[model samples]
Target: MAKVTLPAAADTSAATVKVWDPVVRLFHWTIVTGVVLNLWVFEHGKYAHRLTGYVVVAALATRLVWGIVGTRHARFSDFFPTPRRVITHVYALWRGEDARQLGHSALGALMMLALMAVLTGLGLTGWMMGLDAFWGVKWVEDLHGLLANSVMALAILHVAAAVIESVRHGENLPWAMITGRKRALGAHDADIAD
Candidate 1:
């Protein structure tokens, strides 16, 4: 595995390498599993479907908690894009000059926000659907389907972005997310610098 070494906080002569915390990696894989299982079980197994929905809700809740109290990179503040910065990023992308980031970029952050919104909506609607008054209500059922489809679409875009970034940077971004390691940056990363 490749390791990145930066100037140590205590001593410039020594390099202090930082790595993602375990909670960050756990949340990532758990969400991936939860999303896949939710989709698959919903299609093929009724009981499993509901069970997986609960799992997804749990995972989402965990992610929200981690975002507030976890490591630096895991925090929402670390990756949430500011309006001005997001606009600048979009302009840079149009100019083909966007920088590589250690965490999610502006567009990536937007996608994440969308995905989280959809997931939250789905979870709430699913819960409501379970109530006696709301059970089998056509609008609630349709909203759930709509949110599910949005999640599917966002998943596709997420994968595509990862693939494109990997190809562009000659690094396995998905693997980096899984393993929580990345190669040290170069001068280009310094220049474009997110």
Candidate 2:
């Protein structure tokens, strides 16, 4: 039998590299669907709404565990933003520098963290509302609404940032999240090992 040959990279300007793993991608979309359902489809304080919230909570819990044991880019250690790094990244963007990170950028990582935290808080408050002791409590219900609104605002900002970064770096970031791959690195691109 003839040996199978792999395709040459010379035909393309950049190679394709795996960035997000399947688990990460699944979790990302699952959370998105859950949030959308909770926000627009399901009636608030209903069983379906609460169920979707629980599903989102489960997705978040899995993501937290994955961050501990997942692939390089998926791990928290790889992209957890420090203040200095975030500052530097912001400065680079302000200067119109091409800081093409293979994984989530510093600001992106911070946004991810914030989104997850807000989601967790929403889940908690939602659960509290279900408890008999807290049922019909105005403050608990208000906090839940606040968290829900926060999630929506943060999600909008996240999408806007992704679009801006995609244009700046010449990569389709949202597509990358769906496909689990990104354009390969060029000389000026920042290396993020997976």
Model 2 lDDT tens row, 1-194: 99999986684436789999999999999988998898765555588898898899999999999999999999999998988778888887778774688788888888999999999999999899889999999999899999999999999999898898888778899999999999887777787422
Q: Model 1 over residues 12-128: C-alpha lDDT tens digits?
A: 222222445777777667777878888777879868877777877887888889889888777888878788768988998889887766667788778877888898899899988
TM-score of each: 0.85, 0.90
Evaluated at residue 121, the lDDT of candidate 2 is 95
* Each model's total of backbone clashes: 0, 0
Q: Would you list the C-alpha lDDT of every candidate in the order shown?
A: 0.78, 0.87
Candidate 2 worst ten-residue window by lDDT: 185-194
- In candidate 2 the C-alpha lDDT for residue 170 amounts to 80
lDDT: worst 10-residue window of model 1 = 10-19
Candidate 2 Cα misplacement greater than 4 A, ranges: 1-12, 192-194
